[model samples]
Target: MTAAKRQFHADVFITLKRLVNDPEGIEIRNGLHNLGYDDVSEVRAGKYMQLQVEAANEDEALASVNEMCERLLCNTVIEEFRVSILEPQAT
Candidate 1:
């Protein structure tokens, strides 16, 4: 008998490279400064995604999430991504 696939939760974080200028982040910082929060020097905005994956094992789930990030989740040229895989949950 074959083992059943397990469920994995993946968290993806996408952000722009330091060399890249973030217009939105700058606007946010400007707004903060206007509100009397001048201590805020810089702000960098990013994206966070939570995904539930079905796989036979943790490694498989990780690979799948990585591929998803490389393919569609993130812009590899100007942006970078990080993935965190949680332990399998009870069925």
Candidate 2:
């Protein structure tokens, strides 16, 4: 008998650093305030991506996704990234 390869799903969020200026976020916040949503305090714009990865285990999958984020998905100089692994639901 052979072991089957495990598949993992990841959700990645890429956002600008706190010190970095986000014009789009500011614009959206202003628009919301103008629309009478005065309670809206801060708005931050970011990128969300879902990836299906094939790996032997959760650690391997996470490592691969981290590398992808560092190399291509996010700008490390001015952006920060977060990864969330989604557990497979029972069928």
Q: Write the per-residue lDDT of candidate 2 for residues 6-90, one digit (tens) a residue.
A: 7788999999999999999999999999999999999999999999887777787888999999999999999999998776443
Number of clashes recorded per candidate:
0, 0
Model 1: per-residue Cα lDDT over 1-91, one tens digit each: 8778988999999999989999999999999999999999999999999999998888889899999999999999999999999998766
- lDDT score of model 1? 0.94
State each model's CA lDDT, in order: 0.94, 0.91
| CA deviation > 4 Å runs, candidate 1 | none
Provide the RMSD of all predictions against the true structure, rounded to 1 decimal.
1.3, 1.8
Candidate 2 has an lDDT of 0.91
- Least accurate 10 contiguous residues by lDDT in model 2: 82-91
